[model samples]
Target: MQVNSEWEVPKYELTEFKPKAHKYCVCIPVINEGEKIQKELKRLSHFASVIDILILDGGSMDGSLNHEFLFSKGVRAILIKKDIGKLSAQLRMGFAYALSEGYEGIITVDGNNKDSVESIPLFIEQLDKGMDFVQGSRYVPGGKEVNTPLIRKIAIKLIHAPYLSIIAGFKYTDTTNGFRAHSRKFLMDSRLKPFRNVFSTYELLAYISAKAPRLGYKVVEIPVAREYPKGKIPTKISPLRGNLLLIKILFGLLFGKYNPRSE
Candidate 1:
């Protein structure tokens, strides 16, 4: 699809280069994120002029769905009324839209504004360097994990290790992180189902990293700097709940609950 340059801001022009190297579609799936969407949008809008951007909302009643920033050049907002309350399902819809729009790649990020939008270039960099999926690692060297509490950190390690090993036979320290970029061919070949409407994006990352690599798609982690606020949405997710969800995804992977073949 040819981008309309008139929609671009003064300092930015719609990047017209056909990414023959990669026709990746990017999705920033959002929920009730009113305060931070604009900032995130401005940063993303200015950054990925060459890629199609989709900001999908799952029935955000906070009126955040009406944000004008979503209409900026290289960005489009999708408001889904069937509120499923899960990050993965919302992302699945966004992926469908991106695919329908002829994008050959997809990237998913949290909409709560904790992610550093500047790191998007780094993701593209990794993708361009021949990665099927470039996952953001907060614990990797040179990557800073700001405001993550000690307790949550421990829980993250415990929950991720065994579940990832049992299901995908892989060991990644930071499996629950949401920041991910995917190649279209990988997504098509892996044939994993949309993440159930019950879990967050964490399990989705686990399934992909474990399953994709086994299928011959190059999966690698890139260091990304993350900054969380002093008392925001608590990057410290509940250990018990998170572990239970991880277990579910593990079972799904093992028993074939997610039928990538159906895709």
Candidate 2:
């Protein structure tokens, strides 16, 4: 793939996934996930031969990035300063690095370890077949969720998924899932403008989920397992604040608030 010279790729520390050629990079966006990240990195080690791993850390003070296990697992870390914002900022940083590095595509998985590492290959498989966006769906036929919080589950199924599907004009089982793959071409597309300031929050993923289909990209969802440990909070989403933000994003998409050309 030809690299785009226009994007001013910011400098960051780099570590190799291993001494080998890799066509795709798996980007795991994280905050202060200490032991959870360690465990997830170990789980992802199983695919070291097939794909490279990139850990995008949003100023983890827990020293999770410094853990010896991450190095042993051959996962690369891009530590973003806290001033950049949260999940969305880290993702933008990771995606920019991946594009500049010339990866064919990038597969994103949350660092919380809620998602199955086994589905990584499935994402790459679809990417290889030229899918622009490969979304992981726990509600699909072969997918399942374990120990999910009742309220969160209800919101995802009844509100988030349905609203996104309607806006995108496509039937979708999971729209809020972070376990998805995006072709380098799609990320580098100027019209999408994923690195814009508006994406500094949680809206980036949702916006891209809806924007991809609207822009005529091949978007598909594959079943993947999501398990919340017993007695553990399933997500970082606060019902009131997160839902309000989501509603704002949905309305913005409908009203052309985030359109690149409108800026």
Candidate 3:
């Protein structure tokens, strides 16, 4: 359960914790989610079997982190002391904690309240069936997306997704979606080395999605609803900069610059 110091990026500590027992842990990466997180946690509370609800906070300054509801719901918060590529750094902390705790799998959903907490059972089912990486896709059959910005929607379907699909050698409907699950076996694989400092940003998810299939692990996409409440701007992405970083990460993986196999 010892974490290698070389892989550590920003130091973080978990607080306001209560332990429980279950097969899966839900990792919600957040930063100033505000009132939306309250609704998300309330919905997730109904999923009684999820042992841990780890809130990975990227230094929220809006007083959202101080909300009393989170502590009441038995949610453990890991506050990253520094901003080091917000989402990816938070995820690395969650993944490391989950591995150390010996959970069977970890499920990641956006903290902005866009993704459905109901689909969690579906993810756990796939993990039980031995699927290594389960990606949530709104573009898939039976999936739903509401109020998504036109440009972002188009970018996902036309450019981002298709590009990743091509590199993965498999058809993917939503490669950019952060709603996904990873079995412990997949996370602990030496070939995937997800804890490396190179994954301090958005590149880790993309790398794992493509690398899992390439490494001969079972990967599947499941339908999930992603609903953006009207007038709520997504905090995680900036159209121009996000797209540029994604393109750069894609090419990095393509050229084996970020590929674990090459390392």
Which candidate number has the best TM-score?
Answer: 3
Number of the candidate with higher TM-score, 1 or 2: 2
Q: Write candidate 3's Cα lDDT for 169-225 as tens digits.
A: 778888889999999998888888887667867889889888888888999999999
Please name the candidate that would achieve the greatest lDDT relative to the true structure.
3
State each model's CA lDDT, in order: 0.63, 0.81, 0.82
Evaluated against the true structure, the overall lDDT of model 2 is 0.81
Candidates sorted on lDDT, descending: 3, 2, 1
Judged by lDDT against the true structure, how good is candidate 3?
0.82
Q: Estimate the overall C-alpha local distance difference test score of candidate 1.
A: 0.63
lDDT of 2 by residue, 1-263 (tens): 33345543333455553443588989998888888988998889889778888888777788877746676887755545445567787787788777767789999999998899889989989999999999999998999899877867777889888988988887888777899999988887778888766776778888898888988999999999998889857456676777778778778877877778654
TM-score comparison, 1 vs 3, better candidate: 3
Off by over 4 Å in 1: 1-22, 79-85, 190-203, 232-240, 254-256, 259-263
Better of 1 and 3 by lDDT: 3
Give every collision pair in model 2: none
TM-score of structure candidate 1: 0.78
Q: Model 1, 1-263: lDDT tens per residue?
A: 53223221111112222232236656776767777766777677775566666666765667764545456544644536364445665665566555545666677777777787678778777778878777787877767789876656775667665566455554565666778898767765535444344334444556676777666678787787677778745433575676676667777767765545453
Candidate 2 stretches with Cα past 4 Å from truth are 1-20, 232-237
